[model samples]
Target chain A: AQSVTQPDIHITVSEGASLELRCNYSYGATPYLFWYVQSPGQGLQLLLKYFSGDTLVQGIKGFEAEFKRSQSSFNLRKPSVHWSDAAEYFCAVGGAYGNKLVFGAGTILRVKS
Target chain B: EAGVAQSPRYKIIEKRQSVAFWCNPISGHATLYWYQQILGQGPKLLIQFQNNGVVDDSQLPKDRFSAERLKGVDSTLKIQPAKLEDSAVYLCASSLDGGQGQETQYFGPGTRLLVL
Candidate 1:
């Protein structure tokens, strides 16, 4: 069985400030990881995914996540936040079970100017 | 290319009533997926189809939920005698090839279902 954990339920950051959202997963063997963002009234958009290769992966909208196998974490980070970047973020693990994904609870981000 | 499309952007029904939601995946996409996203929760995979054949449906509640992807194209998910807990956003997603678990899945706007 695979599971994901997002420690932060809600986060608030001012514009131009740095932000980081924590994510951890439990899975057997090497796993495929992904980050998704869901805006108000929209669908879940893929931010980035890590299959293999560089531990640090860059995503759309200036967001990036580092896959730390040692810690079982794939934390999303942004050097600077924008007001429009506010949304809910989710971390998922897959690749072992027919592309089936187990997602985290989600973290809501609020950006203020 | 257009993204996944789902009909009835919003649906309202009472408990014990039946409801159905439709989805049309991207052209030439061989894999389709259905997910349930409850308020304040992440989307949960309900079903996955590979060219009209079910690949995984272990999380689906078979007693009241049924889904079909006939002709390997469009799909519909139905709920009979819906429950209040069934109220959530039904999201449809499609990928180029489902063989690799790393394929990027494009999502639809999702159909909001409200059961009162």
Candidate 2:
């Protein structure tokens, strides 16, 4: 079964600090990876996606993710965290040409000033 | 250009009551999906439709839960005698063509359901 795992349930970081959210996936074959962010009382928005080619993919809102095939991970990173960055982040995986996506539990990011 | 649309931003009903939610996918999108997202958890796919036809509904609870996309554009999901566990945010998403590789799905604002 294909699945996504977000190890951290909640994380707090100081504003202007670097941030990294860990994600791991289990799939039988090459997986389509994605990172989505949701703000309070808002629908989820796509941050970035990794299908093939370059390991690093840039997304909206100044977010980026690196897909590590060997580790089966697609981790999201940000160089400078802002107060607006406090939100829930989810990692999702899908099979080739598969419309259905498997999302992780999600990580709640808290930014402290 | 508009994203997916859902109706009734919030609904509160007593347990054992019936409730229904509606969704309008993006214009020209051929694939529609309904998902259930419990608090503190990820969204779980309940049903999928491919242009008025059912594609994947294995995860949908047919006993008390039902959904349809008759015109292949707008869809509806209903729960009869709703249970407390059924309280969650119902999300609607759409893609141009699910058959294509790496199809990006755009989501709606979601309906928050509360079963008292």
Candidate 3:
């Protein structure tokens, strides 16, 4: 079974500061990775995804993630975060199980203006 | 295109009561999913439907939970004899395909359930 681990439970950053959220996964083979964000009382929105090709993947909302095969990590990053960027972020990985995604416990982001 | 739609934004029921949640997937989407998100945890897959037929429901606690998608477009999930631990946000999602590992799932604003 594939599982995801997010090391951070909560992260706080000042507005305009850079942000990085760490994610690691354990799967038998190369896995499909994704990043999702959830605002309060709102559903999750896709931040980005990494299937194969490029190691660096760009996503909506000025977000990006780098998939490192050697480390089994797909960490989400943003050059500068806004106050509105405060939300919960989740990291997920999918295996051969037909879209069954194993998600990590979310990391709550807090951006202060 | 419009995203997945879910109804009854919030529901509060006593323990052992029954509750149902409705979901309407995006038009033309062939796959629908139901997830349970506990506070401070990521969403857990409860059931999945490829059109009107179930694809995977191994994790579902069938003794208490049941779901159906009769028309292949809309779905409903019901929990009978709800427990306090069942309090969580129920999310609905839809994807364009059911193939293994390619499609992206779009989520709906979840319905919050509180059981006393």
lDDT of 3 by residue, B1-116 (tens): 78889999999999999999999999999999999999989999999999888999988999999999988999999999899999999999999986778578999999999999
Candidate 3 similarity to native, TM-score: 0.98
Model 2 has fnat of 0.64
- Model 3: pairs clashing at backbone N, Cα or C within 3 Å: none
Note the clash tally of each candidate: 0, 0, 0
For residues B6-95, could you state the per-residue lDDT of candidate 2 as single tens digits?
998999999999999999999999999999999999999999899999989999999999999987899999999899999999999999
| lDDT assessment of candidate 1 | 0.94
lDDT of 1 by residue, B67-112 (tens): 9999999999999989999999999999987888799888999999
TM-score list, all predictions: 0.98, 0.98, 0.98
Report lDDT (Cα) of residue B36, candidate 3: 97
Give me candidate 2's TM-score against the actual structure: 0.98
How far in Å is the alpha carbon of B60 misplaced in model 2? 0.5
Error of 2 at B98 (Å): 0.8
TM-score of chain B of each: 0.99, 0.98, 0.97
lDDT of each: 0.94, 0.94, 0.94
Candidate 3 — number of clashing residue pairs? 0
Q: Rank by DockQ, descending?
A: 3, 1, 2
Per-residue lDDT tens digits for candidate 2, residues A2-112, read 899999999999999999999999999889998999998888899999989999999988899999999999999999999999999999998787578999999999999
